[model samples]
Each structure stands twice: as structure tokens, then as C-alpha cells.
Target: MPREVKKRGRRQEHKERKAKTTDHHQRSTKRLKTDHTADNGNALEVSGDAGDDFIGFDIAQPEGAHELQEETQFHGLLEPQEQEYYANVNNKIVANDFESAEDRATFIEAVHRETEGKELKVASSQSCSRYLEKIIMLSTPEQLRRLFSKFLGNLSYLVQHRFGSHCCEMLFLQAAKHVEKEHNKNASTNDDLASMENLFLQAAEELEPNMGFLLTERFASHIVRVLFLILSGESLDDDIVKAMLASKKKEKLDAPASKESELPENRRAVPKSFRTSLDRLIRSGVSTLDTTYLRALATHPTGNPVLQLLIQLELSASGKIKLSDENSVFHKLLPDPELEEDSESAKFIAGLIYDPTGSHLVETLVKQMPGKQFKKLYKNVLKSRLRSMSKNDTASYVAIRILERLGKDDLAEAKELIVPGLPILVSRRRTGLIKVLIERCAIRGVDLQDVADVIRSEYTKDDIDFLSALLDFKRNGVQDKTQKKGSESEKSAKSAHKTDVHGSLLAQAILQTSDICNLVQDSLLAVDVSTLTAMCQDSASSRVVQTALSPTEFNIQFRRHFVPRFYDQIATLAQDLTGSYVSDALWSATDGLHFMKQRLARDLANNESQLRDSPFGRNVWKNWAMDIYSRRPGEWQALAKGQERDQPQGGPQQNAPTGEKQKSAIELARERHAQKKSHSTNRKRNPATGANAAISTNA
Candidate 1:
């Protein structure tokens, strides 16, 4: 009984101990759980709390023990808030929820709140552009174009103000290309293109003034190209095409009325206001527009209709803008105030007329100005313009028309104008203008002498042929006028005197003209011998002749006179007889002697003429004639043989008989064979060699 009681007591005591330990452990667990929740909630609010103390007893940490514990607990607790914040922030930033300025501002404000001062970054322009691209991809073609137009509209202002005029121009160009591409893809999308066109037109209206500088000289051509594309229905709107056509038709219809009304002072004044406005615009920096653009406006059918109007206005204004007085009010208003011979604006104006498309403009200019003023202005502009042109390209078709117009009304002024401008044509070798000028001068009954004088003064000697022709026409005019004034009997005498005067003037002119030798040759070949011989004897001809013909003309004159007579005699002799060598030889000998006498007389005459002109006439004449005589063995031998046979020892040789004797019987026979051998040798040489030898030998 005692042993059982002891064992039971031990068991009871063990149970009691176990129950106490369990109760204490349960209390500690309850306290730790409550403490851990409180600590976690407050840890984030505490500075450097670490939250490690709140970690469960079962947890273990590595190197960043406190940090890892704090992060894990903090993240676990704040995961919902973080996710909610990020979601709201991303939605506000990326979503197109903002349609208006207010919405966009509000959304941006929210992003800033979410980011809490940590750099609030927004999408870049490129990003926005890419977003737009994606929208474009998903959108219909029309929708895409509309969006593009809207984007362009918004960007253009920014592009112009923020970037520059060039940027704005580029943007518009890009927009145009984009619209063009879309239009190309779907022809039916022209409506969309038309809408864009309207937008561009509106934009152009507002931006054109500011962007004027962007239209460089080359831009004119680009604009024209664009207009052409539009006009041809290649890439432009129908409205623009219709407008251009209507404008052109209106211009054509108005042209005749304008021309007719141009005669009246009040009617002519109508274009002044328009001209003033255009001049103002051009002077206000629009002149910087690329030459290409100007050319396009002038040439391209679809180019800006307004540009055409402006061109007309400019041309009209050019007519009104005159240099009348030293302090001319209207002239002062002109863009180029300096009346320089070579003004830039003048060149530009000339170029405007030079273009084939500017033909109408030139006609309009002529019509608008007073007849006299028009001639003067046209000449000035043309002269200035031609001077600016390339040597090879100076003779524009427009110049010809201007000259024709001038010739019709004011031939004298036209001649004066052509004098300066003629060199330009000459440099270009434009024979067409030359012929046209000559005809016009003739038709207008302009004094050929005056025209010739002007041409001679202005152009080089190489153009003397042209000048001489003009002079000939003038001389003929004088003769015609004189003949008209006199009776038939007196007409010849009067005409002869007039001819003499004209010939004298022409000779003087020819002598004074450059390259007199060449001029004489060309003139002699082209003009009548009567005219040439008269010119040769004229006092004015002395300048060129004296310089060119000191010794050579003496020989040349003799040759000139002798050769023709010799050929005439040879023809006569050849015609008279056929077979009979002895008779032919005797006849040839007689003819040869006659030729020698005639040549000697000519030489003597030429020497005499030279002597009369010079102080040492007699001696010079003797020396020259003797030199020529010595060169002819046939004549010299004949003279020696005839002298020996006629005078047994001594007798004075008479001039005529001596000349005949020089080429007498025997020497003439030898000369014929020698001449034949020389002819054979000449025939054996190449034609080119012979020609070269001839020129060289003559020189």
C-alpha cells in the first residue's frame, strides 16, 4: 500500500509541472503575436526601425539580416498600396484619357503625386510621334490623313515659332509629301487630299509671309513642280486646278481689253495701284524667292495663280517706274533707287522677260507704258538683262519680240537700244536677231547710216560685215529718196551725187572700223564694185586703208585691175580660134604682151595713186613699178629683145612700146611652158596643202 501511494504522488507532481510550463508558453506566444503585429504596423513610420524585431522567431536571415527582414515585412504589408499607386500612375501617363488641355494637366498632376518628387518623366516627342504612327497604322486611310493634318496643324505653329521658318517650310513639305503618298495609294482618297489641301491653303495664307524667306531661289522651281503635279491631276487638288484654269482664262480675256484701253491715260492708270502693291511686296523681301520658284510660276501651267498676277503687276509697275526727274517721287518709290547701268533688280526684271513664259508679261509691259517710254524702258531693261546673260545664251526669243515691238513704233530708239544689246547677240552669234534688226530697220525707214554707225561703234570689227550691209541699205535708201525727189533726167545725176556721199561715208566708216583688211575683203565680195571702189577712194576710207594698205594695196590694186582684164583677154583669145598651134602661139604671145602692158599701166596708176596720197609720190611710184616689172621675166625679156632688135645700139624706149616689148616674141614662148610646169606642180599637191600654201604664200 505505501509503494503505490509514492508512485502516484510522483506522477501527480509531473503533471502539475507540465501544466504550468504550457500555460507560461501560451502567454508568451500571445504576447509575441500581439507585439509583432503592432511593431510591423509602426515600423515603416519609424526611422530606421529595420522591422527585424517583428520577424517571427522561426525566421532566419543572411548578410543583410535587418534589411532583408524589414524589406520582406514591409513589402508584404505594402504590396497592395504599391500596386494600386503604380497602376494609377501608369494609366494616367500612357492612356489617352486626356482629350482636352484641362484633362492632360490633371493627369500630369496625378503622375507627379504618384511619383512623389522622384523625377516625373513624360513621353518624348519621338514617343508621341511613334504613338501617332501606331494610331495611323490602325486607322483608316482617311482617318490617318485627317490625324496627320491635325498633327501638322498643331506642329506647324510650333515648328515656325520654335524652330524657324525653314522648319515650318520643311514640315509643310513633309505634310505635302505624306498626303501625296496617301493620295497615290488610293486615288479615291482625293477627298482626303482635298481636305488637306484646304488646310494647307489656309496655313499657307497665314504662314506665307513669315515663311517667305524659305522660298529660296530654288524653291520657285519646286513650287512650280508641285503646281504642275496638281494641275495634271498627278498629286494636287481639283479645286486648285479649277482655280488656276479660271484665273488663266480671266487673264487671257482681260489682256485684249487692257491692250486696247492702254492708249487712254485714265485706263493706263488702272494698273498703277496693283503695280504699287506688287512692288511693295517684292521689295519687302519677297525677291529672295528662289529663281526656280519664279521660273515655275512663269512656265508651269499649274503654278501659283497669284504668282502670275504678281508677275503681271511687276511688269506693269516696271512700266510705271521711270527715271523722269532727278528727285522724281515715283522713281524714288522704286525698289532700285540707284540708276546704275547694271542693277540687280534690272537683271531680275530682264530675266522675267527673257523667260518664254514671261512673253505675255513683256507684252503687257509694252502695252501699259507710253509708246516712247516703253521703247526706252524696254531698251534699258533688255540691255541690262542681255549683259547679265551667258555669252552663249544671250539671244532670248523674248529679246526678239521686244525688238520687234520697239521697231514697230520707235525705230530710232530701237536702233540705239540695239546698239548696246547688239554686242550680246554678236557674242552669242545670233544671226537671226541681226537679220531681224536689219529688216525692221528697213521697214521702219530708219536711217541706215545711223544704224550702221551705232553698230560699228558698239560691236567689234569681226561684225563689220553686218555693219556694212546696214550701211549699204542706208546708201540705197539715200539713192531711192533722191531719185524720188528728182525728174528722170536729173534723177541719175542726183542719185550719183547721193551715192558718192554715201559711198564716201561708207568708206570712211569702213576705214575706221576694226580689222579693215578683212572688212574690205568681205565688203568687196559682198557689195557692188561701184560701191567698193567709191569707198576705196573716199577720204574717210583713208584710216583703215592707210593702216592696212601702205605697200600691199599698190600691188593688190594692180592685181585687182589686171587679173580681171587678163581673164577677159584670155577669154577673148580662147574664143577667137581653135586648132592651129602656131596661130594660137602667136595670138597668145600678142595677148600676153597686151596683158603685160595693161598690168604695167595698172601698177603705174596704183603707184601714182599712192604717191598722190604720200609726199614721196614720184620716187615711190617709180620704185614700186620697177619692182613689179623686175618680177616679170616675160615682160623684161620681151623689152630687152625688142629694144635690141628695134634700136641697133641706142634709142629711148617709149613707155607703151617698151611694155609691149618686155613680153615680146621669145620670152612669151618660154613663159607659157614655165606656166604649164608650175600649174602641174600645183595640181600634184593636196588641196588642203595648196590652200595652206596659198594663205601662207600670200601672207
Candidate 2:
């Protein structure tokens, strides 16, 4: 389409659409007015009841809520001055990332005045809720304490209020240090200590009665976490403990009956929206838990993270706490036949081995626990179960790290643990884990036929090549930042020259198992040529193509064999926008890194005629020609003589097509000199011939 004609069509269409939209709006307004006139009498009849109730509820104001009937719209109606005040407070709270003391005070004073039972609910608009979370994070201790006073006086009332419940959660999280320090203060007398520890015990005791109400509360469930933190470790106060028990029951009851009915004993439960928040609550305050409470959380999706944190705490802090007592969570990991494989105690240890949330705990024991504890945990697992768990995504990540950690300590046991699981890891394409087992188990002299079988069956040749490229850079320590392949790693290099970051990073952290690099190189060399060629053309796998084709120490022999056999493809790769990267790597290998430079130089020198005719080949030739002419002038003269012998026009075309633009100033000057010499020779010959003819005529 002509540019101006196309633009005019678009402009005409836009005007027609705008006219239609305006007409639609006018029609809608007229319809609304017609409907309102018809309902005016009914609205007048209901206006009497609207003074105290709007839409059947009090204090139910929405940001811009309104009605055709005004009778029921007055529930949250405020004086003009009051509306202006809250609006200004909301703006100030939302404006500053780090609010000043003055802004905080203004927010607190405004909330304090209207902090009565249901008054704060009016401020729970979508915009208000969004900014309120930010203010909760920035609140000062003094402001929080005063704010807490407004709601804590009536805890149940606060629980029922929409926005008040959220405000209370912030007060509790920020007041944690204040309470903890108060509990440890230097008090000469009990009275001084109790006063310092006032809020901790007072809040806990006052809120204890309504624990179930708070736990099941849509916005108030987090309050239960705060009360639990105030009770320091090992001090299992029965009432507060009972409150926690009640909260768990509340979590169960809060679950919808339909979902509860849908799940069977063996099936996973439907996830709750609030589950992660409650899990984080448990994780943050897990230090205050006893073994009994820790056990309660072991099998829970969210609660399991709490037990994991407790295990980490126990291992890292031996002086401060005891964890192997009869009442302790880990006490069960010590083998006993009566504990049985399917028993709660055995299942608890098994959960850590395979559960996504629980695997890190298993990894901790493998990597950092005492030797005796490591043996106890490993022996407890059934080999079949270990195989089953290795196939899981999250579990496999930690499982590999565990294998390596154990391999370093006792190679024999690590092999036994890894060999059985290799098939599952390979079938699942858990390449990361398969690599660790390959490296760590190889040194232990364990046979890897089963693991190798899995890799062969599952991964394609390109995948194998990618793995080899990662292996090369990993061994070489030359990394590119574009490791990951998705949106999260968008900061990756855009240049075709750069390598993948995750592939490089994953390979970089590989154990110093040099034999594994050789094994991967052999596998790559053995990959089908057709498969390798297609892989080289792919953007995702091209980095691997570059590294594999380069003359690295690990792949030097293979590169020599591969490059000459497919010289045509190698030359084609030189000029391709994407494939050009591989050619660049070859140049770097021959000149820069000097990896078998003589072999590469000899190969190129023999292909001189081939390089002259191809575009990308000529690019490679120019680079080598510059180097030879600068430092090896004698060799340069011989190379020039050989290349210029059969030039198309009996002169060097310099790789340019036939055109006026193809001739340089030097070539043009040579042409002019040749023309002048020809003219002078012709003039001399003609004059001599004419003089001879005249002499003959006179005779």
C-alpha cells in the first residue's frame, strides 16, 4: 500500500470508531436516566432506612461506590471535613517510601481517632490495603505501640475489623525485638522484669481466649504467629500451646467441605491461599517451638518448612539448645525396628529425604551433620524409596548435593546411595544431578553402565553437545553471562559471541573430576554427524557448538577430526549471523589462545583456494593475511603469489564483484599508465612505416 494512502485509511477508520463510541455513550446515559425516573418513587420509600444502613451494612464505603437510590447510601457517609482528613492521611501514607516522623504521626493520629470497633474498616479500600502493607513495613516502634493500644484494647473487635487485623500483624512482627530484649533485661527484682516484659505476656494472655477466632480469620490468621513468638523456646506454656493447637484445628475447619471431601487419605490436599503466609509465619518463629509442636508440623506442606528450619537451628547452634532428647524431633532418626518404615517416626525421616520442602533438611544432615548422624539417616532410607524420590524436581536438586557431600566423606556408601537412583535421575532428564553422580561416583570406581544407559535413552545429541560446551567453559573458567534461557535471566548477553550463564555456572561449580570432562568429550565425539549439524544451527545450542569445535585441551583430537570432515559447513558458519560465532571461536583458538595453533594454521593454508571463493571463508582469510603480512613478510609473498596466479581478470579482484566500485585508486592509476604506454608505441611504429613507404615511392 502507498504510505500516504494507508495513513488516510487509518485516520478515516479512527474517526468512524470515535463517532460510534460517542453515540454508544449517549444512548447509555439516556437509558440510565429513563431507568432512574421509573425507580424514583421506590427510592423515596427506602430513603428513611438509609440513615444508619447502606446496602444492608454499616461503614461499608467503597472508593467511589454510589447508587441510583440514595436511601441506602448513607451507612459510611461522613462529614465533608472527615472525608477530607482521611483522604489527606491516605495520600501522605502512600506518598513517601520512607515516611518522616511527622507523616507517621499524622497517620497514627488519624487512625487513633477512628480506631473504634468498625470504624477502621472504612479505610480498607483496594488502594488503601495496597499502601497499608508498605506503611506496616516502615512503622516505627513508638508509633506501632500507640497504634497497638488503639486495637489491642479490644482484640476480638480488632479481629472482626477489615483493616484493623492487618495493622495488628505489623505491630506484632516489629515488636519482636522489643519483647525478646525485655524478656532478657537486667532486672534486680521481679517487678522491674515483668514491667519490661509487659506487652509480650499481656498480649499473649489477652488474646488467648479468641485464638480460634483469630486463626480462622481471613485477615487475622497471622496474629496467631505473633503470640507464639512471644513464648521463648522450651517454655511451652500450656494455655498458649493450647491456642496453637486450636489454630491448627482452625486451619482444618477453615478448609472448604467440598475440597475436604475430594481428598482421600493417600491423595494430596487442595492448597490454601493463606497456607504460604502461615508457613512463613511458622518458619520465622520456629525457634520458639518444642519437639511436640515440631512433630505436628512435619507432614504439612507449609508446616514442614518449620521443622526444617528447626533442624537447621539445632545443627548450627549446639551450645544453646538440645535436640536429641527423647522428646526431640530428630530422636526418631536413630534407628529402632519398632519405629517401622511406615510409622510416623520413620515416615518423618523419609519426608525429609524426598519431600520438596523437607529435602534441604536431608541435605543439611548429609553435608554438615556429625558422621554418626549421617550414617543413621542414610541407613534408615529404603533403597527403592530413595530411587522413587530422586525423580522429583525439587528433591533431585538437594539429592545430588547430598550425594557429593557423602561421597567426599565415605565413597563406598555414597556410591551405594547413588547407583540405585541413577536410572530415575536420567529418565527424568535431571542432568544436573546426573552430572554430580557421574563425577563423584567415577572417582570411587563405581560402574556407571546403568546411569550411562539412562542418559543415552533420554537426552538428544544437541542436549549432549550443550552439556559438553558447559563442560569446556567450566574447565576453562571463561564464562558468558547468558547462562539461563528464560525471562528471569534477561540480563544475559545479546551478542552472538557470548555463552550461556547457567550452563557455564552449573558447569563451573562441578567437582574437580577431570575424568568426567573426558567422558563427556568422548560421548560428544560419538554423537551422529547429522544431529551435530542441526544442533550447530540452533541459537540455544550454538554456544555448545563453538566450544565443542574449538581446539580445547579436552576436545583437541575430536575438533581436528570433525573440522576437516565438514570443512564446507565450517566455512558456511563463518558468515552466518548466528553461526559466525563458531568461526570466531576457531580463529580465537588458532591465534589468541594458541591451542594447537600450528595444526589449525596448516589446515587453513592447505584450503587457500577454497577460502578465496566463499564469503565467510574470505573473512577468515583476510584475518590470517593481515597477521602473515605484518609479522611474516616472506611467507606473505609466497601466499600472495599462489593466490593471485588464477585471478578472474588476470589481477586480484580482492573478493569484490565486477563493478566500477570494485577498482581501487591504485588499480585505476595502473590502467591509465598502461593506456599511455600503448598510445606512445603505436605513434612511433606508424611514423617509421610511413617514412619507409615514401622512400620506396621516390625510387
Which candidate comes out best when scored by TM-score? 2
Cα lDDT of model 1 by residue, 2-76, tens digit = 554444578889999999998876665443335645766422223132223221211221222122112112101
Q: List CA RMSD, all candidates.
A: 37.8, 24.5
Q: After superposing candidate 1 on the true structure, give the runs of residues whose Cα lies further than 4 Å from its correct spot.
A: 1-200, 217-221, 224-310, 316-402, 407-409, 416-428, 435-699
TM-score of each: 0.24, 0.42
What lDDT tens digits, residue by residue, belong to model 2 across residues 329-425? 3553332434455666566667666565566555655565565555555556534355555577767765665566554445455555565666555
Per the 3 Å backbone cut-off, how many clashing residue pairs does candidate 1 have?
17
Candidate 2 C-alpha error for residue 366, in Å? 7.1
Model 2 lDDT, residue 411, Cα: 48
Where is model 2 more than 4 Å wrong at Cα?
A: 1-129, 153-165, 176-198, 205-297, 301-321, 324-344, 351-371, 382-384, 393-401, 404-412, 416-427, 435-464, 467-505, 508-699
**What local distance difference test score does each model get?**
0.39, 0.47
What is the Å distance of residue 181 in model 2 from its true position? 9.5
